[model samples]
Target: MRLKLLAAIGLAATLYSCDDTTTGIGDFVADTDEITASAQTFEATTKTLKYTDLNPNGVFSRTSNAYLGKFTDPDFGTYTTDFITQINCTEDFEFPETMQDIVSTTLELSYSSFFGDSLAPMRVRVDMLNREIDDDGEDLGLYYTSYNPEDFYNKNEEALAEQDYAVRDNSWTKEEIDSIKKANGYYPPLVIDLDKARKAKGEETFSAFLKRKYNEDKKNFKDSYSFIHNVLPGFYVHNTSGEGSILYIGAIWLRMKVSYLIESSSGKVDSLVYTSIPFAATNEVYMSTRLSNSGDNLEKLAAETHNTYLKTPAGLCTEVKLPLKEMYEALGNDTLNSVSMAFTKYKNISENSANNPYKMGTPKNLLLIRKSEVNDFFEQKQNYDSKTSFLGTYSSTTNSYSFSQVNRLISQIFSDMRTKEEPAEGWDEYNTLVLIPVKTETDSQGNTIGLSHDLEVNSAKLVGGEDGEKIKMEVIYTKPKFNK
Candidate 1:
């Protein structure tokens, strides 16, 4: 089936020609009218902006060494794997009253409002507008290198190996001294003492001349002691234009553009800048119904995306990994603290434990339930107990959800997993799988290990024993049917 597009427009053009009867002076010349220069219709249009993978092979560096750099805005943010379908174009294409706001804020901000077609805007506009960088990597090296007397001593040893090439204490040549004086708009207070230079040049001592310059004539030295030699990387982006669409007859044209600043230290995208504009047109124009319908569609699509992502093995793996990294960071450098945190983070069970599938209660423990199973659970509850069946409403124990709530969540997930090739699934019912780490501890070398300790209920038996004991559950109510 062909997917419906959000924007559709048509353009027209015409051409003309004229002929002359020049047989004689009496011959009459004929003139004709013609049309020219019209816009054409496009079946579809799509564009995407992507960052060239800095690590071209998509692999991290092999060197074990690490570096510390200043953090930039939008440098280390989380990527919600869940699909998030949203309406990008809500305002009519009327020229914005405050043009300055366009420059200060993200022009293509995502927002929901009462407007045309009830169609939810595809958040692709936003993701397409921005870039993602995983700055979550923790560098343990930064800790010891900065302080730790032992590390400092070891670094000194490394430096001593190339002592001959190290900075000289007083070995400033006349030319070098002159260059520095000219750079700072002054002559060196005194010429480099030749005897002092010979004695301290290989001794790894700071230059006495440099010290005097810093302590006495600090202002003059500031210009001479610059860090221009520092090696750094950066990413640069330049936006060219915006995407526009005509909503209604004589309606305004909504336009949006994508741009972002770059991180100079690591040469990565720092933040995204979106620019949008609305053209003005006079007409009895209203887009509430259209916006509402779009919103509804987006809600549906988001829900579909959420389930498909969480239920997948890769999604489950990512769900498991994110928390582990966070927990490790929280533990800090203390061995005991790290060990305790590790155990707390990873809890498991024994093979012979009574529980079957294993019960996980952590927020990171993602529960992916089949849509059918969830509906069945609700239907069963409604039959035996007469209570509010709204999916959003929850009981004191089990978190109750409304269809809309679940759909929205799922739809957001779908937006994250945007791909035309991926098949969409229906929410007939829903169920979930929980991940629990039972056994965890640190070894002598400070490495943490985890082991599964127990088992819990399985699919066939919603709640049962480790040996696959089934719950004596029953469903009295059934889904309603509509027919002619």
Candidate 2:
């Protein structure tokens, strides 16, 4: 037997010399030797499932931008988004004592981009909150996308302001828009005047009310907490009328234009200085968005078996049922070398269509994680460990998101199976994984530093499902020649 083993080693070395493709010690050995190497591909079952994370705690702690307006997709139905936010007031905030009067009070919704028809007419309404957002307690504030704004304000009462506008400024000529873009690199915000108070008749204007509050007590402007609780609660902003458009609002600003008298050294009024004080919605204060979806079209799409869909901001996610037990049974005591899986996106056919020209693009980043660990993983803001959790970037050239190697994931799953006294029978449910759309925050060096649920508008159709073509997962492994 010893002589035969030595002969096998010598033969394996000769094989390695002849084949430059030999990768490992097992690869050099023949099937008759002590160790053998081989590769095989398995099909993984996948299907789309409706996703919602409206837990009492929160779905996300914070978001980079707020979504507003309503958009109806040809296949996916109608999506409406609204937000309630507390504007931050600087600590010890105060207006100059020489301030003459309020010129204008405007709520500016600043956005870098929007989805859907630019010319679609939309109406937005803003109302002052009667109660403060509950954020101060043992538990952190709830920041999910399904919050109710009616809890903070009275919908029956008149709103502070409402405006009819479009995603693109129809009032500005092409030349004027180009000039503004040349100077600012972007267009101006959708400004809504809030000077008039519509809540009550014979009452002070919204700007006058702010001035009066500051005059009454300066302590009310001591900090954001005090300001939101005492002086001004916040604002509940929603679309009263709109369709076929959704704006990705980056920031919300409440600007108060003031005309102050500039005095000379002798205390004589010389000139007037017009300026604006801005109170903005920031991370320090609480902000929540409410997302609503309607229509049977979305239901029909989610039930599609030929292809799986991925939609963002409280939409569907593809669930993959990994056959770990089957893999273990096939390769009893083998060592998993590598496992590669890729999800190819279906090209958008509506891109070239004249009727439905505006189509949402696929999510730039995706996360593959175990279904059981998803909530904890996101709640803890954990990054992909490349083991149980992995990240895939979309490749425009190939139109696919591929995970080149997941051998660690396979090894981990197998290790878990070994610890059980008996063969794990009902663990298939826990062995499942989910694919989620994510927005990744990168550093200056282009390294990903943070990950969160993508709140922007995005849709993707992947080629995989139970009744459709199953996703192919290439697995490479080595085992004892006798076992094989």
Error of 2 at 63 (Å): 0.2
Looking at model 2, the pairs that clash are: none
Q: What are the runs in model 1 whose C-alpha is more than 4 Å off?
A: 1-86, 91-93, 96-101, 107-126, 129-462, 473-484
lDDT values, one for every candidate:
0.20, 0.76
lDDT of 1 by residue, 448-477 (tens): 332211111111101122222221211011
Estimate TM-scores for all models: 0.17, 0.86
Cα-based lDDT at residue 415, candidate 2: 68
Candidate 2, residues 331-426, lDDT tens digits: the string is 646766667799999886244322577878789999998887877777677888677788999999999998855667767666666667555557
Model 2: weakest 10-residue lDDT segment is 19-28
lDDT, residue 474, model 2:
75
